[model samples]
Target: MAEVTAEARIEAPTGKVWERLTDFGSYGEWNATHTNFPDGGPETLAAGSTFTENMKLMGFPAEVLWTIEELEDGRVLAIRGKGPMGVIVGTRYSLAEDGGATKVRIDGEFTGAAVSLMAGKLKDSATAALTESLRKLSGLVA
Candidate 1:
């Protein structure tokens, strides 16, 4: 398995940050790995809701079918997906209000036979993408 995480303190309230984070319509604007939502994002996000997203990572494009595993309004969102080559992917977005700013963190996990073949490179790529996504998200909301 390969795991990656990134966090940032955005100069914005948790509410504002959460709005942008869940606004899948504008996801590509700030999400570095997001290419597009093939069937559009979930109309309502709740545990068990499913969505399809196209993503680019490590110079490759893949389609992932994701199911929301957990949701806590503005606090947390977690999803698990099935990707190419039988790979399993999990992502979680966490937010906390800190003073007037928001502390945001993204955690990603990848597993399966394919992941073992490229764990190191995948970690690097995913870490970079997560960091870049947080930077862009901050730019939009902060």
Candidate 2:
């Protein structure tokens, strides 16, 4: 599996950051890098819940279908995404409490011919994008 993991330290409290991250419906409002969806939010934190969204990666449009596979309230969220071109992506969002801040970690695994072909370059770019996205999000909620 090809993987990319990125982390960011946000000056927001863990609870606040968790709420913003899980508020997938409004992600595009603050994170301009993501495609907007009217009803593209998580229905529930339970496993088996699914969410559909349109996303872009390195200027390529992608339809992301996420299935909630695991959850630990306020701490961890696990999702699996499927897309065209042999794409299978698993992502985990973890939140850790720090002094007056939140340490957020995002880890994703990509399995597909398209992803493997450009893993190294894609990983670096994706990581940077994630960092910036989180930073923007933090600023919005701060």
Candidate 3:
């Protein structure tokens, strides 16, 4: 398995940051791995809601069928997905109000036979991607 986490303190309130985070229409603006939502972003977000996302990671493109696993309005959003080659992916976005700003953290996990072959590289790439994503997200809402 491979795992990565990235955190950033955005100069924006939790509500504002959460709004941008869940705005799947504008996801590509800040999410580094996002290519597009083939059928468009989810119309409503709720546990068990599903969506298809095209993404690029480690220089390879993949389509994932994702299910929303958790939701907490302005506090959290977590999803798990199935990708090519029997790979399973999970991502969690967590937010906390710190002072007057919002502290956002993204945690990602990868598992399955495919991951064993390139766990280290996947970790590095995902870490960088998450960091870049957080930077872009902060810029947009800060």
| TM-scores for candidates 1 onward, in order | 0.99, 0.90, 0.99
Q: Which digits, one per residue and each the tens of the lDDT, describe model 2 over residues 1-142? A: 5777878888989999888888876688655347865455777768889888777877888787889998999999998989779799788889999998999888878888888788987787777767777778878666
Question: Could you give candidate 1's per-residue lDDT for residues 1-142 as a string of tens digits?
Answer: 9999999999999999999999999999999999999899998889999999999999999999999999999999999999999999999999999999999999999999999999999999999999999999999998
lDDT ranking, best first: 1, 3, 2
Ranking 1 against 2 by TM-score, winner? 1
Candidate 2 residue runs with Cα over 4 Å from true position: 30-33
TM-score (C-alpha) between model 3 and the true structure: 0.99
Tell me how many residue pairs clash in candidate 2.
Answer: 0
Which candidate gets the maximum lDDT versus the true structure?
1
Task: Tell me model 2's lDDT, rounded to 2 decimals.
Answer: 0.81
Candidate 3 error regions (>4 Å): none
2 or 3, which is superior by TM-score? 3
Provide the lDDT at 37 for model 1.
Answer: 98
